[model samples]
Target: MGTKEQLLCLLESNRERYVSGEKLAEAIGVSRNAVWKAVNALRAEGYEIDAVTNKGYALSQENDLLSPQGIERFLPRDHPFNLIVRKLVDSTNDEARRRAIEGAPEGTVVVAEGQTAGKGRRGKEFFSPTATGIYLSIVLRPALQADRAQYLTTAAAVACAQAIEHVAGKQASIKWVNDIYCNGKKVAGILTEGAVDMESGCFDHAVLGIGVNVKPPAEGFPAPLGDIAGSVCDADEKALRNRLVAEVLDRFWGLYRHLPDRSFYDEYRRRCFLLGEPIVITRDESRVRARAVDLTEDFKLVVELPDKTRLELPYGEVSTAHA
Candidate 1:
């Protein structure tokens, strides 16, 4: 742990009361001046730390700041993953790809405050602004063969839905493949991309990118997305971000360790939004209007078309005619 993290741990450990600067400096083996600098830095990062003349400092319980220190406190004491927090990035998924190519271990996570080029399925642009959402990507090297890789996206959707429910205390549902919804509006999206070794026919690594609208933009969403886009919650920004990230990693890692089995299938299907609903699937120049009937074992959407035929569509943009 660095000086800032050490100081944060001390304050977080004693969040209810003041911890003397002298004692903090002694515990962390730093001078009082260094402690003051650390406090100032933390304050700049949105931590609400109190300082008085006689009393040293007390960290407010609602010190909702998104940082390595804040996230680490909520994570297990001895986590094995490498967590990279960035102020800005083109995309967390892109960053994870760069890291994976350079041999970043499985479970490495990249989180950014903002994304300049956020992405969604079918090459769509996800509306990502600064500081009001959760943008993160996780790197995984599963032992399964390349054909089974699609399950990762399914697992990611389930993990994200569960995490959102756990943190926001609200129910969340999922669209066919990667979109998560709350109250019938799109609140989050998942994009899963994989790199394969041609000769071995196995995946080199896979990156799962997730973006959730935790808070609304000051000006609200753009005209194109304004009608469909929505936030998962309007709670304290930093506290929600920290808890959501930790919970997602915890839930994802647990399901990932048992991949190809897809034990989350039952829960995932239960939370699906399009089951037995009239829908349209668009691909290139083709479009199919159908009734979504079920989600299959392989994560495909089973639908009944106007021709009275059952079709299992693997991927497409599903939208209700009524919407």
Candidate 2:
């Protein structure tokens, strides 16, 4: 662990009481002055530490640090992902795409506290007010056929669901394609973009972007979306933000290592709410009413027509499979 992380860990493990500078110095093999310096550094980093004259320092238990360095301390050592925690941005997905063009390594994460231009599935406007949401994106370079790329979206959806459950103790559900639902409302969304490599018949790189609404005003949502949207926290942003990032990334990394697994397809479908619902989807200048028959792993929508005949619709059509 780095010096900053070590100091933070020490403070966190003994949060109940102050750890004297002399004792801390003895334990960490640093001088008392050095311990004092470390404490100052943490304070500078936005950690609310109370410094008592002779008693040393104590981290305020109620202070939840969601800063980049603070989040880094909670991650696994030598984690195979580059995590970028931003205070603000135009959009995490847009930033990740820019990074991909610059040849950023796979698993490079771009997370922001707010997005000025956050968007949702099907070209819907995303509301990401400042310090009120978790907007995140990740770059991935998987050598898989385009035919197999559909599973990547489902994999990421499951990752987000699993992450939310672990971090917030909320049982999140997936609404087909890549939307996470909790408590009868939306919680998060993911978008995937890729570069096709025809020569090698594989995708050179893919970027999966996720935006989780951690907080907003307590009045529910705004205007048209008020009835359709909700937040994880109507009061606490810090706790929700940090936990969402840690859990989402942790789950994403696990499924990403396996890439496009069909076994997870069943589990993902079970958590879906899109299938079996009466819906009218616009496909190529024609709107068709079909019952969602089943969610196929190939990114095809099995929607049964009025005659009960099942027709598989490619994900590219039907606007977006998400509800």
**TM-score of each candidate structure, all chains considered together:** 0.94, 0.82
Q: In candidate 1, what are the lDDT values of residues 1-323, reduced to their tens digit?
A: 87888998888778679989999999999999999999999888877999988889998776655666656666887776688888789989999999999999998999888899998887888888877888999998887677776688888889999999999887999888888999888999999888999999888999999999988888899997989999987744445687788888888888998877789999889998899899887878887788999888988899998998998887778788586
**Candidate 2 Cα outliers beyond 4 Å, as residue runs:** 1-17, 20-47, 218-220, 234-238, 284-287, 316-323
Choose the strongest candidate by lDDT.
Answer: 1
Tell me the alpha-carbon RMSD of every candidate.
1.8, 3.7
> What TM-score does prediction 1 earn?
0.94
Residues 10-100, model 2: lDDT tens digits: 8876867998888888878778787778888888866789888888788886566565554555577777778777767887888898999
Residue-level lDDT for 237 in candidate 2: 38
lDDT, model 2, position 278: 79
- Candidate 1: the clashing residue pairs are none
Q: Looking at model 1, which ten-residue stretch has the lowest summed lDDT?
A: 233-242
